[model samples]
Target chain A: MSEPVVDTTHEEGETRLSTGGLGRTLLVAAGVVFWGWLLLRWANDWLGGLFVPVGQPFVAPATIESLGASIPGLAGAFDALAFAVEYLPALSEGLWLTLVLTVLGIFFGFFIAVPLSVARVYGNLSKYVSLLYTELLRGTPLLAQLFVLYFGLNISGYVPGFLDGVFANNAAWAALVGFILNSAAYQSEYIRSALQSVDTGQLTAGRAIGLSKVDAIRYVVLPQGLRFAIPGWTNELIYLIKYSSLAAFITVPELFKRANDIASSNFRYTAMFTITAVLYLALVITASRMMNYVEDRTAIPGLGTGSGR
Target chain B: MSDNEHTYLLEVDRVSQSYGTEKVLRDISFEMDRGDVTVLVGPSGSGKSTMLRCVNRLTEIDSGNIYLDGERITGPDVDVNELRKEVGMVFQDFNLFAHLTARQNIMLGPRRVLGLDKEEAGKRADEHLEMVGLTPQADSYPGELSGGQQQRVGIARALAMEPKLMLFDEPTSALDPELIGEVLEVMRDLADRGMTMLVVTHEMSFAREVASEMLFLDGGKIVERGPPEQLFDRPEEDRTASFLRRITEMHS
Candidate 1:
């Protein structure tokens, strides 16, 4: 019985090790492909497309022919690679728009969130106002919100003249506005929890030191609470990066929209979308690493680690 | 504003407070003059902390009035912030801003409330940090410092405001046995410098040594009040005597 048990444990360990190895190998492959693609694009731009031609689907006919003749299985992989190389420029443009939408949405959302979270935590009757705003925005779908802003509001001429020149088109502005509102609602919830997690003694100590209610919050509570909110804010930012794709429905030519257009035209949805997915994954991984750096830099010695009182 | 000569730095008259149905402080009243070190000692939930909180208007009174520097502070019309500027408080938990260094915590009040420039505030902060014997830990965050050092920073933060009266809500109650002495030493030093302080604590030794007057509270009321020696050696009330005896035994 003991020998059988040992054999079973050995089998389980072997399976676990193989699976872990495979996952690590896949991750390394993804990183290499991402960096290689970035370097190729930069080199192509700097050298004026000496290696790979610009503004056309890059099909290296000689390389594909030779590889296919050697191994019939290599033909499909080469074709997919050609498709990705051809459409990456358009996809890169879309990715830039996606980055802008997510960054600005989160940035503006934060300003609104700070006041909303403060109102929710400290206001008298105004807390209910904040609650209503958060609930209305969070309770609905982001897609529906974009549709309402773009079709209902923008077409109806309700969008103000001040933002006319901010974007190339009205739909992008609508998407930006919708994202700001939706993101603010969610970010305020994170901030509210963060503010509440701070010790009440902090407020007492603040007031005791002759700080007015507002000053105490501005100086003491907010600085500490905002640090606690960093992890939550990072999560919101990642979610926003992915959710920016929803703006595609409203005709905003972001990353997902560009992918959809190219895939639909070529009828190679699987190949086109696989590369698109990789690009997004690369983006998200980069964002999370940056946020991790931010969290570490801003972290106090004992906070969130249960070391400080 | 006339320079009115008042006998007391702080005066609490017939102040009562309750949290919902449970009353924490009932008609509590006290008066402290300049250079006075008054300590309130009692069992837990007996309103010692509440009394200290009420002095600073941190806890609103259900009735009666509190006056600091001969100015009424309890009314709605009075500016609570300005009133608070004359009263500084230290807490049992230290409650130092975790994100800030010891020096920054001390500089906060002077720079924000007192409208002092950065250089002036920094100088004041260093002075208070040196006074608490924490000048070496000036750049350390509260989380990086030991409990005793953190409490000393808390003391320094309060002292930076240069308040007329200082309220301490069990400043050493949260410290470990080894750490408590260092905090008590800082408090003793403050008292020796003629700072008017009102403290709440169960440290009978500290109260006996440094307290000019002691009030024994039980069941939301003062059970005994007199000099520390009177309350400790010859309590007029059995409740005070028994509570003191029990607390002393526990500490020992």
Candidate 2:
């Protein structure tokens, strides 16, 4: 029995060691790639005009040809590498647009969600209205919503003068509006559940201490509910970041759109799409880490975490 | 209006309440003078807690009036929030706001309802924390404190409102056997300080020790009520005597 136990332990140790080594290698590779991208971006800013004309793409055809000549039968790899380097700047610009859309969508969605959730939980007649709004947004596809705002509204001539600039031609703004509405509906569900999970006695206690109904909710219920909703809220934000890719269908020049445009033109789908995926992965990991830090900082001692009492 | 209406700090005159067909309180009448500690004692479902809730307008009475300081509080026109400010309540479960520290919980009423500045509210919270012997645990969250300590904080939170009368609804019922004494001790101290209180409780000894008048309620009516010794020792209604015997036996 002891010998079998020892054998099992040794086998587990070997498995762990191999996995750990693989993880370390991946981490080092990721670090090298990240720093190299930053350095390349910096060099491009300073020496880009000398290397490639301002109006043209930086293809580096001579370097690709020299590498292909030196390493026979690896011409495809060299071509893909040169294509990636040429379009990295465009992808970075697209990444910035994606960040802006996700941040604005989630931030504005939070404001709309709080009131909708409160109405859903507490309002008498307004509850039905809030329910209808959430159901309508959540039931439909975000892409269809974008098309309605971008194409349907323009064709119908229903776009207001101020919003004509946004709906008539601005696909990015239309996509952003769709994202905010969709995100608010989903986020309200998360917040409503959080609000409901708080004990009814909390409101009673609030009232017992001379707080009005609205004050009770504003002070006691919302504070606890919002804290509880943080994890779900963060989940919505992550979803928004990935689904921002759908904006590509509406001609938004976001990360995935840029990747699609470059890939279609150059027929380097594999390289272009893979780089876009990596950039998205980086954004998502950074967002979740920042949210995790927020969750840790705001956690109460005796609540959720079970740290006290 | 009666000539002696102003004599009592709280008056529930023939208040009746029902949830659907089941009547929870039926024509329950009671009065408490300033500085009086009146204890409502009864078996489960006897409407002791409901009676206390009616006094604070937490549960509105179906047919009758409740007056605080001789002003009728049971009407549509009455400002319930302002009434609640004067009527502080402590619950059986010690419902301290879970997210806030004990001090902050006490300060919320003063700062929000009374519109006191933060420094004034903080000072008031400290005084009440010390009053409840919870100054050391002032900064701790409700989850960090034991049940007794939480209930103490609950008492302090209510007292910070400087209410004219405090209602305690089975305040010690949810506490463990050992933890009940500390909460009762705080109640006993409040009575000594001449704070008017209406309490619904099953703790017979505390009721006997602190209650100025003991009201034995049954079937949503006060069957017998007088000084604690009269109800506890002297002859009264058979139901009241029997109920007292059972409660004393259980406690002993």
Candidate 3:
């Protein structure tokens, strides 16, 4: 009854440490804090130079004046946000265009990558076709793809007209084509890695149990592989935020292009760039949180308590 | 039942497997009978698993014919999902779907492949779990079970297929020493109840206790084959004799 485990059901050999166990833990934590403090002390030298008081301190501190008290900067950011809100109808319209472009681009990109990833995995075509597609996509720069679509394809007489005037001109569609193919190049790699990470033994087991190769892939292999790819897929999703900025080059007028237009008109360069940084940061943060939620939900069962193999 | 003995249940004639220039199995041939337990014993990379995988067409044989129930194998033309409905397999790693409960893992094939109604699949899963002595663990995930219990779930999952033939690849080799006996007991019970089985294993006691015929494979070829007593007690080939002695010597 006086054994280490108070509960009879608990395993006897396991022992619990005293509360003071964290004293050494605190010591290690203090060492880390000390190191971080040293690094920050060095960084403050340069950071201090960039930020200086230009107006009255909010609290009128006795020891030192507030350096980050740039009321104009705050007011400018708020004005930028408010200006965006004032242009809500236009920005909302721009928002819709951005969403439409992203959704369409990803959908077409997914379609394109499925065949490409499959070809890469199964070597569906002759060596010439598979190797050609893989090397072409992997070697070419995405910006070059945009340039090719906007300028080269136009000259080469490859114009198609479905989305030619939907976003006010063919430039949007041209951007769509570039973004889709560029994203597909990256996504094909994502899907291929996902598929490869799945155990060959699982496929063999599924087939041995009488599943056809396609059925086995659909039922067993895909489920397992997709689980592993979720984090990587989310990485690609967040990358689309930064990647969407590239659309401005082809005159798609996504967030960055909108901000750029506003910045040029207002002549407040630093303020506009700061506002852009904040918005992009918000987008990436929200996307990351949603992705982490999904990852947490789909985590392997035995792993929740951290004892997973 | 009477016709089971009269015709070979499975026949592999002049089977060959290759990848480009490298041949894996060279014109391998064998026949399996109904209501018989055949043990295929081999060292690693002996093409024993490849032969087992080919029976289910998991590995494509370059040139060969397989006969199941006296019908031509015709690997490409056959409906594999339908074929798998009648032929079950167990793996050394157990390969129990970690996400599903033991009951769900067993029922997955019956639902997806056999087209059994959910209710009927559930009933069958329960019965098969009972068969494998895993009734109490029906709701547990595979990860929650011990290795022997997980292997039993693998057996249950296979049994749910209601297959005519069962193939087991190194089922007990991955299990802990204390756990192997439980899995082998399940296999022995399966054999006693007249399940046609082709097992590849390293457990000598299991082979001796359950097999009606034994094959000793070496270097991708069948080096020796006989009844367990003949193979274990009086092996003709020096390799077979040496292998058996080595296995027994390790056990001692």
- DockQ of each candidate, alpha-carbon based: 0.33, 0.33, 0.34
**Fraction of native contacts (fnat) of each candidate:** 0.64, 0.63, 0.36
In candidate 2, which residue ranges exceed 4 Å CA deviation? A1-83, A155-169, A305-309, B4-6
lDDT of 3 by residue, A1-309 (tens): 001211123122211112364764664465555445333433433355222222222123322212323454565445444544333333333444565676677778877876676666755554356557667866987677777888787622344565345566466777778768777767777877887877677677666666667777777776666566666777776777677777787777876777778778878667666656655655565566566556556655542211131
TM-score of only chain B in every candidate structure: 0.96, 0.97, 0.95
Q: Which rank order by lDDT, best down to worst?
A: 2, 1, 3
lDDT for each residue of candidate 2 in B1-252, tens digit (9 for 90 to 100):
464535578888898999899998888888999999999998899999999888888888899888898889999999999999999999999889999998999999999999999999999999999988888777777876788888988999999999999999999989989888889989999999999999999899998888999999888888899999999999479999999999889988
User: Considering summed lDDT, which 10 consecutive residues are worst modelled in model 1 chain A?
Assistant: A1-10
lDDT, model 3, position B205: 86
Better of 1 and 3 by TM-score: 1
Q: Compute the lDDT for candidate 2.
A: 0.84
TM-scores for chain A over all candidates: 0.80, 0.76, 0.65
Name model 3 segments beyond 4 Å from true.
A1-100, A126-138, A147-173, A302-309, B1-5, B13-30, B60-65, B74-82, B98-101, B139-141, B219-223, B236-238
Among these predicted structures, which one has the highest lDDT? 2
How well is each residue in A1-309 modelled by candidate 2, as lDDT tens digits?
000110111112122212577775775577667656644554565475554554234556568767876888898787766766677777876777788889999989889999999999999998999999999999999888888877787432444567666332367777778888889999999999999989999999998887899999999999999888887888898899999999888888899999999889988798888989988987786687567667667778655431121
